[model samples]
Target: MVFSLFSFEKIQKQNTTNIPVSVIICAKNEAENIKENLPLVLEQNYPQFEVVLINDASSDDTLEVFESFSEKNKTIKIVDVKNNEAFWGNKKYALTLGIKAASHEHLLFTDADCKPKSSLWIQKMSQHFSSQKSLILGYGAYKKKKNSFLNLLIRFETFLTALQYFSYAKAGSPYMGVGRNLAYTKTLFYEANGFIEHMKVRSGDDDLFVNQVGSKKNISASVYPQSFTVSEPETTFKNWINQKRRHISTAKYYKKSHQYALGLFFTVNVLFYILAILLLSILFQWMYVLGIIGIKYVIQTIVYYNAAKKLKEKDTIYALPILEVSLILSQLVIVFSNMISKPTHWK
Candidate 1:
C-alpha cells in the first residue's frame, strides 16, 4: 500500500535538439488504424525523429497505406517482411528488423492501433532518456466509450495493471511494460539479447524484455497526460477474454522474484473476497465482513483515485468495487485457462 504513494512527478524535458529517436511500429492488417493513428505520431512536436513502420505480412491494404504515408513523409521508413518462413508471425522478429533499420540509437515503440494523447507525446516520453537510464515506460490507456460496460472493465483493468507495475517500478522491483507506449535504447535491446530468451513465447516482446533488463536505476517512468497513448478496447467479451489469456501466458516467464510478489498479491486478493463471502453466509458475521471490506475499499479508492488523476482516467473511481470483483474473477478464469492450454501464435 505504501507503494501506492509513490511520486509521479514528471521529468524535466531534455534538450532534444540533436537527440534523434526512431519510433517503431509493427503492424499486420492495421490499414484503418494506420490511416487514422499514424498521422498523430508523425505530427509529434519533437525535433528529430523517424517512424520505422514494419509491415509484418499483412493480407490487407496495410502496405498501400504505408506506401502512401512514406511517399509524403520523409521521416516514415517502411520495412516490408513478406514470405519469411523463419520469422512469419512473430512480432519480436519484426521489431528486431525495425531496430536494425533504425538510424537512431534511441528507439520508441507503440502499436499501430494506438494514438498519442497529444503532440508532445514524443517530447514527454523521450525526455527521460539519459546516459544512466535505458528504459522508459509510459501509460497506455483505453479510449472510453458511451454505455459500454466491457469498455469500462477493460479500462479499469488496464488502470489497475498500470498501478501495480508503476508502483513496483517505483518500489525498485520493475517488472513489465505494455508495448503500446514503451521506449529503450538499441544498446539495451541488444545487450539483453533482444528477447531471444522469451521469443519462443508468443506475446513477450515488451513486458518480458523489460522484466529481463530493467532496473530501478536504469528504468524511468512517465505518467504525464501528454505522454499517454490511447488504444481501442476489445468490444466483445470473448475477444477480451482471449486477449487476457494471451497476456497471462507470458507471466510464467517473469523472474521468480516478480512471480512470487505477484502471486502473493493475487492470493491475498482472491482470499479476501472469498473469506468475506464465507463469513457473511455461514458465520453470519456481516458486521465484521463489511468492516474489513470497507476498510480495504477505502484505501484502494484513495490510492487509485490519485493514480487515475495522474493518468487522466475519468469516471472510473466510482466503479472500483464492481471492477475489482470482476477483475478477481477474470484473473481466476485466465489462470485456469492458461493451465490447460498453450499459446501458439503472437496475434
Candidate 2:
C-alpha cells in the first residue's frame, strides 16, 4: 500500500533576512545536558537569532553554565527564576517568561537535553514560516545506542508518534507537536493566552498548547533531516514509563476531535492483534488467518520503513513487529496508570 499520507515535501532554503528567529529553552537542574547541548544551539548557522535559556531554579551548576555561555556569546540571553515556593516545578511559567523575553517575533523551542541534528537547524525550521503559517512542527528523535530490545522499542515508539502527528498535519488536521523541536510565532502564543488554562497541570507545555491553537491552515511541518533534533533516551525502564505517563496525562486535555481520532487509532491497534491471535488459534482458518496477518505486516513494514528513512530512524524497521506488540502493552499500562494517578512533576 502507498503511504501518501506520511509523505512530506522537502523545505528549500530561502532568504531569511526579514525573519529573525528566537530559540527558547527551559532548563531545570540540567547542568550536564546544558554543558553539552547549549553550545550547539548557540552556534547555529542561522544569520539572525538569539538563544533564550530559562534557568528555572537549578540547584546544580546549570546557572553557572548559562552564565559562562552568556559572557562570551552576546546572542545568549538568560532568565534566572530563583527558587520560589509559589513557582516550584512549573515549566509552563518558565516557558512563558522565556517567550516574553524573546526579542524576535518568530519563536523556536527545544529542551536543554536536545541537540540539533545539524548547524543549519534554525535556518531549515524557519524556512517553513511565511506570512500565513504561524506554527512549525519538526521531528525530535532519540539517539540510537547499542542494539537492544529497549533501545529499538524506544526508537520505534518515537517514530510511530512522529508518523501520526506528521501525517495528520499533512492531512490538514494538525493536533500536536513535540516541544523538543517545535516552533511557533510569539503572536500565536500571546493570542492564545499562553497556556493560562492548563497552568495547573505539570505537563502539556508542547502538545496541549498546540492542540488548543493549531489549525489546518496555520500549521506547517519541517521533516527535513537538517531540521531535526536528537536527544538522549531514558536509560532505565522506570524513567521511560514515568515519562510516558506524564505525556499520557495531557491527552485528556486535547480537543474533542483529536481525542476521538487518537482514541479510535489506539482501539483499532489493540483489537487488531487480539483478533489475529484468536483467528490463528482456529485450526480450520489457519491459512486465511496467516495470510491476513502477513498482508497487514507487509503493509506496516513498507510504510514504517519509508517513514523511518525520512526521519533518520532506518535501523528501527527491523524491530517493527516486536515494537508494535510492546506499544500496545505500553498503551494499556499508561491508560490504567493515568486512571489511578496523574504525574505531578514536569521534569
Candidate 3:
C-alpha cells in the first residue's frame, strides 16, 4: 500500500526531557520589534538557553537596539555579518550564521516580532529535545485583537491556516513547520545540508526543511500553552497578503509528495465549492444555496473548532468558512502577483 499524504498516524505525544536549547533570531531593520519583543527571549523561564541575534546588515536603528539589549542582557549576543563573505544574499545567510553561533544541541527559533504567550515557552520547546534528538516542531499564534473588523479578518485568516496545517498534522499529514517558533537539532540541520536546496528562494527554509525530513518517530509537537509564541500581525490586508504570497510561492519547491497533498486540498475545496454552486444553481432553489453554505460551515466549524481548541487559536476557528472563502480568494490574488515580483520585507 502506498503511503497516504493524509494518514491516520501522528507524532505521538512523548515526555520531552533535559536538554539545553540555543535560540536564534535573524533580523533586519527590526528595531521596533526587537525592543518590544526581544526582551521576552532574554527573560524566558528556561535556564539553560542562549539567544543569538544575527544582525543582517540592517540599515536602520536595529544595531543600536541590539547594542542596548546586549548591555543589559549578557545572554543576548549580537552577531554581525562580516565583509569576509564574498557572496551572500537574504535571510537564509543570516539564519545560517545564527545557527553556527548557537551553543546548545537543540535550537529554538523565532522572529523578533514575536513574543512568548507564556514564560514557559522555552521550557515547552526544549522538552521535545529529549535525551538526544535533532528536531522538534512547535506552534505559534497571532496576537489577540478585539477591535476593528480588519483585525478580526486578519486573525480569522491566520487562525484558520493554522488549523489546516496543524490539524492536518494531527491527522498524519505534516508538511512544514513555522519559523516563528520552531526548534531543531543543531546537528541534524547541518547533516541535512542547512537550507542548501532552497537557499536562493526568499522563503521555505522552514517548511522545505521539514518537507525533506518528513515524519519520523522523532518529530514531536508541544501542546502546553506556555510554549507557544504570538506574533504581531500585519496591520493591513495588502501587507499581510504580500507576506503570505511570498511564503506561498515557495510552495512550488515542496517535495513532490507534499506538493500533491496540498494540491489535492486546494483543488478539492475550490472545485467542490464551484461545483456545488453550479449544480445548485441549476435547481434554482433558495433552500439549496442555504443548505450548501450551512453544511460547509458545519463541517468547517468542526474541523476548525478542533483546530482552534488544540492550537490555542481562541474560538475564532468557528468563524473559519466565511474567513476561509475570503482567504482562498485572497490567496489566489497574492499568489498570482508574487509570481512576477518576489516580496522580501513584511511591510
Among all candidates shown, the one with the greatest lDDT: 1
- lDDT per residue for candidate 3 within 184-240, as digits (tens), equals 887788888898877767677688787776465556667567788888788887888
lDDT of 1 at 76: 94
Clashing pairs in 2: none
Candidate models: Cα lDDT each: 0.87, 0.86, 0.73
The lowest-lDDT stretch of 10 consecutive residues in candidate 1 is 2-11
Relative to the true structure, candidate 1 reaches a TM of 0.95
Instruction: Score every model by TM-score.
Output: 0.95, 0.95, 0.88
Off by over 4 Å in 2: 1-3, 8-18, 83-86
Clashes per model (N, Cα, C within 3 A):
0, 0, 1
Candidate 2 residue lDDT tens string, 1-347: 11447843444455554379999999998999999998888888878989999999888999999999999999999998865576578898888888999999999999999999999899888988988899999999999899667778888889888998888887888889999999999989999999998887878899998888888889888877999999999888778888888888888889898899999888988899889888788668699888988898887887778788889888888877787888889878888987898765764
Error (Å) of candidate 3 at residue 25 is: 1.1
What's the residue-level lDDT of 7 in candidate 3?
Answer: 23
What would the per-residue lDDT of candidate 1 be over residues 1-347, giving only the tens digit for each residue? 64564534344446543479999999999999999999999999988999999999899999999999999999999999875677668888888888999999999999999999999999888888889888999999999998998888999889888988888888888999999999999999889889798877768899999899989899888887898999999999878988988888888899999999899989998888888888899866688879888998888787788788887775787898898889888888888877888644564
RMSD of each: 1.8, 1.9, 3.4
- Ranking the candidates on lDDT from highest down gives 1, 2, 3
